[model samples]
Each structure stands twice: as C-alpha cells, then as structure tokens.
Target: MIDKNRVFRVLQLAGLVGLLAACGPSFAAESDAAGDEIEVVPVRGGVYMLVGGGVNATLQIGDDGVLLVDTMQEDMAEHLLAAVRKLSDKPIRYVLNTSGNPDQVGGNPVIAAAGSTINAGNVAGAIADSTVGAAVVAHENVLTRMSVQDPPPPFEGWPTSTYFFTPTKDVFFNGEAIQLIYQPDAVTNGDSFVYFRRSDVISAGSIFDFTRYPFIDVDNGGTFAGTLESLNNLIDLTVPEDKQEGGTMVIPARGRLCDESEVVEYRDMLTIIGNYIREMIDEGRSLEQVLEARPTLAYDPRYGADSGSWTTDMFVETVYREFTANGSSEQ
Candidate 1:
C-alpha cells in the first residue's frame, strides 16, 4: 500500500532543493563590507578589534606602546593606521600575523613602518637602528609561503620574527603575556591564534570565521581534520564566566566578537557535517552522489554559499576529497 515511487520522487526533489539552496547567491560575502570605514571596537583590557578592510585586526594599547595583530590589506593601511592613531599615540611595538593571506598581512609594510621598535642603548647611548620599525611576528611557514609567491610581498611586509617546530611562541608587552599558538594546516599551514592573557581575549585568525564556511586551502597544506583540531584547541583555550555565557572573548578572522558558547556551536556544526560526509563516503558513494546527497543541508541556511571565493559545494568536495584521497574514510 506504500507509494514507493512517490516517496522516491519526493526524496529526489528534496535533494534538488538542497542543491538549489547551496547554489543561491552568496549572502555571506555581500554582508561583510571590506570598505574604507574601519570601526574600532574595544574589547577588555586595552584591547580593541579593528573591523573592516576585509578582515579584523586586534590591537592592545597601553603606555608601553601598541601590539597589533593582523594588518588587513595593503590598500587599507592608511585607514587602519588612522584608526590606531586615534586610540594611542605610542609606537606599535609588534605586528602579529595570524596567516600569510594577502588580506591578513597586506598592510604590514605600511603599518609596521609607522612605528618604531624598542632597542637597547648602545655604547654611544643612542638606539641601534632608529628605523627598524615594529617587529612582525608569525610562523616561519608564513614567511616561506609568502616569499615564494609570484610577486613576493614587500620586503618590509615579511615577518621579522618567526617561530617553528614549537607549539607556541610568547612575548610580554604592554603588561600582558601574549602567546601565539601555531595551528598547522587549518586555514593555512601557517595560521596562528594570538592569545592576550591579561585581556582574556584571543585573536583567532582564519581558523575561526564567524561569517562564512571555513576556507581550507588544501593546496596550501590545509586539511579539514586540522581545522577541526584547531577549533578544538580554541575551545580548550577558552573559559566561560558562568553557565558558558562569558569569560574569554574571541575576535574571529571576520564578523562580531564572540565567547565560548558561540565557538562550541560552530565546532558542533563542523563536526556534524564531517560525520555526515564521512558516513556517505563509508557507504561507498561517489563524489557526485555525495554532492547530490547534500551533506551540508542543515547548515546551508546559515553558512552555505553558492557563489563566493568559497562555497558549500567546495567545502563538501574538500572534505570528500580529503577522506577519499586517504583510501579510507578514517576521519
């Protein structure tokens, strides 16, 4: 008595609907304005989130000088610098890069040049090099990748300080302990999460994007599993004030500031999608069948994109390829 044919047709139509939704115009990209206006939002403890210029940059200002994280793009350096000047007249002591993406480090040359580095007094009682500028710190992999680009970044933009083979690098500035935790193969192999201990804030680079689906640059050694691991690491570093409501604040690569709870939700979403795709792969489904299955259907309404630099289809494919390439759906 069951209408088997009707049920099959209904399922097929549902898959088509999911596909259509995934391919809809990219609302995620349009919503984020990478324009001239840079909004300076204060987080706790002399820390601020500079929003605009395609990505967010974090600044910790005090009497000692400023420690800035991420420098937006090259063109927006002036706007970003103007915003910094408004907050503090002190020199920028350090520029911490989360990744090597152009949007994340493009303004390095200009921004770093605008500040002076702290140097010990020489025998002559003068500074060693007055124009040394602020120290740009990042994972050595960032310098390696950026240096080999078609048109390499400006010499001034290259990181002056790099860490590798170590899980984290730490420095004390502006009365706070800042730690740069290396997150391999997340957004890129060189991604870092900068934690301001005194401020109780973390500047999570591309590892966490509150707006759109995480962009895993497979060509650049980024892996879906690694991204999930980094998100887990983020959760580990955070502590909630009460009932998981507030405590440690997070400034994502883009979008609004968040706390522990929001991060858990994002992590859960990725985990669920990963499980769905992995199950389909274990069923011996081909890539085409997998796409048609719409593993990301539930999250499409929130993080899906049809036509952006990254899309839902792209994410699904990345996960699928990552799993199948291993010849086993282990992860």
Candidate 2:
C-alpha cells in the first residue's frame, strides 16, 4: 500500500524541488553531462519534462500520483519508471498520448503495469474510488491507426481509453484539468496536444517538434495546412510571462523546452516556407524546380537539414504536394 503521508510530502515539497531543479543547471549543460540518462526538469505547477530517455515525456506529479503524456519508447521503460519513482511512490494514474508514433506511446504497457492500482476517483485526483490500472488515454484515431500496422504495434502500447472530439476532449488528473486537444493532419490524423490547465504547460507531442522540420507524414493523413493550424491553436493556448518572455511552457516531442515566443517563431517558419511553396505552385514550377529554389535555405542553418533524417527538401516537397493537390487542372 502507498503511504498517504509520503504522497502529501512529495506534493508539498514539489514546488521547492522545482525551484531547485530549475536553478541547478542549464538543460544543455546538464543533458551534455548526463548523456542519454533520463533527466527531469521542473516546468512549473509540479509538472516536469523527462528528457533524453526517448521522446520527451511530461510528468504531472501530485497527490493523485502521476499523470504522463507520451511514454517514450519501450526500450526506455525501466529508466523512465525509475525516474518516476524518484518523484512519488503513489501509483501512476494515467498515461495520455499525443501521437501514435512508436517513440510516443511505445512504453505504454510497461509503465501502465508498473503503476499500482488506484480508485477511479484518484485517477482524476479528487473524484471517487474504484479499482483501475494506470489508464492509457488518447484520441480514437490513434487507437485505430496503431491497431493496423504491419506487425501491428504491440497491444500494450495501444491506448485503453480513447475520446472523440470534433475539437477536443477533457480529463482531470493530479488536480489539473487536462485538455486532449486534436491537431488533425498535423504530424498525423491522430495527433493531439495535452494541455495541463493549472500547470499552463502543453505536451505538444510531435505536432510541434522543435528539433527539425515539422514532419508532415503525408502518407499518414498529415498536411502542411493542418500542421500550421495546430501551431496557431497552440499559440492561442499560450500566455507569455512578464515582458512577453516565458509564461506557458511547451514541451515538444523532442528538443529543448520552449515558451510562446519560440512557438511563434516556429509558426512563422512554417508559414513562410508554406507561402513560398504555394507561390511556386501558382507560378507553375515543377516539384524539381521548387526543390532547386531551396526556399528553406535561410532557416536550414538554424533547423539543421544537413543530415540525420527529414531533410528541408523533404519538407518543401510535402508542402508542394499539399498546396498543389488540386493543381492538376491548373497546370
């Protein structure tokens, strides 16, 4: 059985823990020193981002236990589990997903099973009591897509609980009202950003990858226009702090933590690149011609398309295809 007093102690000390964590070291320096070790950084309101293990996972720890958004990959389970144990001994009440990508929900089964049983009320942190495992929650589409993969992603990683929203759905956990908002056709049809209301933090999933060009998985129901809409909606939910600097914290699928201003810059990048592609289409430029123009050249240095994966040309081609989907008649 979990200790009630211990839960309260962790909850009460969370603010101080966050303060200490924030002031301790820069994420870059710490991540460089830590090197692939799962590092936890306090965001605010007892919300934290666990980086370096796999895809970024957001942990909300409170009297309710733990509520997680995006559970990295399965291989990192033990590391992530130990990291959660470092925060609280209470059960993990819920695991929410922002994308169906393997890196996002790959650890669902292990982490969910590792969690102790809890009353349904505790799942929401203030409701009523009923027995349950740490629930896996996601948009209905994520469940559908993950179910039909070649090998079919493991069942353990599939979301046990799915919500349908023409726009968004809401859940309560760890004293925070979590909004599982949809961003259809952004990274994929299933993408949803988890907004922790009290914490003012958005676990942006892959819809807002700060690391590289927004991966428009065209084969998976993604569109440049849809991703742009997602980013604009994210900006709407953000509230900057004094001097419009840092207020609402955003934890993307990968890369450094950021605030509204950084999001705006990213949005602008997508907008500019998108408009350039649209104009090229209007000018009747072939995909090869558009690629040669290298519209993303100005931003490539900052976003880094020199290697790894997801090149700038790939992003440009995606945008070109999306904007010209109706252009066969025009050309």
Candidate 3:
C-alpha cells in the first residue's frame, strides 16, 4: 500500500521549495525614511558610530571632518548621508571599509558620487575611483581572477587604490592613530580590520558577525584555518585583558556591539564545526553524508536561527568546500 510515485513527487516538491528559498533575492527592504535616517552611537570621546544605511558605519569625529567606515545599500545612501550630517558640520574625510562584501561596500557608488571622502582600504577606493581605473587588492591569486574578468560590475565598485604589500597600515588623525591591518586571508581575500586607538574600539567587520553564519568567500581566497587565525590575531592585538573596557567593543557589519570574548568563542565554534566536516570528508563522505552528520548541532543554540537569509547549511557548505579544496589537511 506504499505509494512510491506520490512519495517521490512530494520529496521532489520539497526539494524545489528549499532551492527557491536559498536562491531568492537577499537584500531586505530599506526603511521608508532610510534615505533620511542616520542613527549615531557614541563609541568614545571624539568618535561616534553611525550605523544605518543597512550596514554598520563608524564615524570618527576628527578636528576638521568626520571619518566614515562602511556604507549600506545604494538606495540607503542618501539616508546614510542624512544620518552623518546630524553628527557634525565638518566635511566627511574618510570612508573606510573593513572588507569587500557588498553589504559592507555596496553603497559606495552613491556615497562617493556625493563627494570626496577618501574611501580607505580595499573596496573603498573601488567605489571612489573611475570604473576603468579602479584597482583590486589581495594575494596574487585575486589579481589573477581579476585579470581573467572583473568581478561582476555590480559587485566591483572598483577600488581606486590597492595595496598588496604590508599586513598593516597606520594613519594619524586628530591626534589619534587609526590602524588598518590585513588578517591572514579570512572572511574573504582582502579582509582587513580597522582599529581606532583613541576610541579603544575595533571594527572587525564581517569577521565578528553573530547573527548569520560565518561567510567564508572561498572564491576570494577565504579558508577555514585563515578565518580562525584572523580572529586570533584580532584578540591578541586589540583585546588584551588589561586593555579591554569591561567589554571589548566591535561593530559587526549588521548587528549590535559585540565584546572581545564573544569573538573568540565564535571562532572556536567555527573551528569545531569545520573540523567535524573535514573529518567526514577525510573518511570519503559525500556532501550529503556530511550534512546528515549535523556537526553544527552543538553550536546551533548559539548561532543557529530561523533566518534563511544566511543559514546553518550555508556555513557547513563553505567550510566543507574549503576543506575539500585544500586537500582536507589541517587548514
């Protein structure tokens, strides 16, 4: 009495539904007044954070003008502009991106067209520089990919400036030193962290996000080991126990301020999940078998949510891809 055809058809329909959900458009709707809304949070003395426009934007109030970090969506640009104006009359001096992901750099085009704020680091220049002249920065491998074909135009804001050199760069503003350091190839190819010495705050960008699954952009040189290494570097450099202010503050691309230890824990959780999948791969398990293993079960309560926007499966897939691609070794 088992209806095999009917059962198979039902399973097929379920599969199609899951696929559609995963591939659906990812951007959420901007606020009706997002164009005019700019929310500011005081990070410390002279530095305030303006975190609307769909992505978190940090504002460091310099003597002459304010420095901005990250812009949200293109549609939310004007709203972000409105938000910044509420903070100070000084011209916007610098707009830095912690990474190259669109959510972090997408609003660059509109924000740059509005005026001459130095979009610092990787994607910043991409947004400000002319289309033909923009540069891409990363390891030589990224350059190779760029040479074959530019990243999708929409994705390539085209960084006007590129530095494939040092792991760290420091700039002085208003008697404060802001340091930009490249991590060991985590999150994506050109992931960098912005450390504001004066505010005693660090914007680790996507490297510290808590809401969604960790996004390892393998195509852009991200790796499982690299992600953990990057987090370790941040903790060592900025979150020394004596220096931590009760809680070390971090501005995630799209969430509330997180503390230093939270980041460490996140990294450890990722490492565990990544290791579990790697073990499965080494045993010659298929991707399906790895999924069935459900290695993320232990950490699900901490990071798992119902949001299909960025789900647990996506995290598992990213780590497994990296594990297999890199020969399933320690990294």
Q: Give me the candidate number with maximum TM-score.
A: 1
lDDT of 3 at 272: 60
Candidate with more favorable, higher lDDT: 1 or 2: 1
**Best by the lDDT measure:** 1
Clashes of each: 1, 3, 8
Tens digit of per-residue lDDT, candidate 3, span 1-331: 8656435544554454355335433122322323446667787777665666545777777564556667766667677777777767665545566776666666665555444533453333323323332222223332333345544434344444444677776666666887877875787777778888877788787777755667778777776678788888877765535544334577777555656755665666676667667767888998888787666765564466556667788778778877887788756
Against the true structure, candidate 2 has what lDDT?
0.78
Give the true-structure RMSD of model 3.
9.7
TM values, all candidates: 0.88, 0.84, 0.74
Q: How many steric overlaps does candidate 1 have?
A: 1
Name the Cα RMSD for model 2. Answer: 13.2
For candidate 1, the TM-score is 0.88
The TM-score, computed over Cα atoms with residue i paired to residue i, of candidate 2 is 0.84
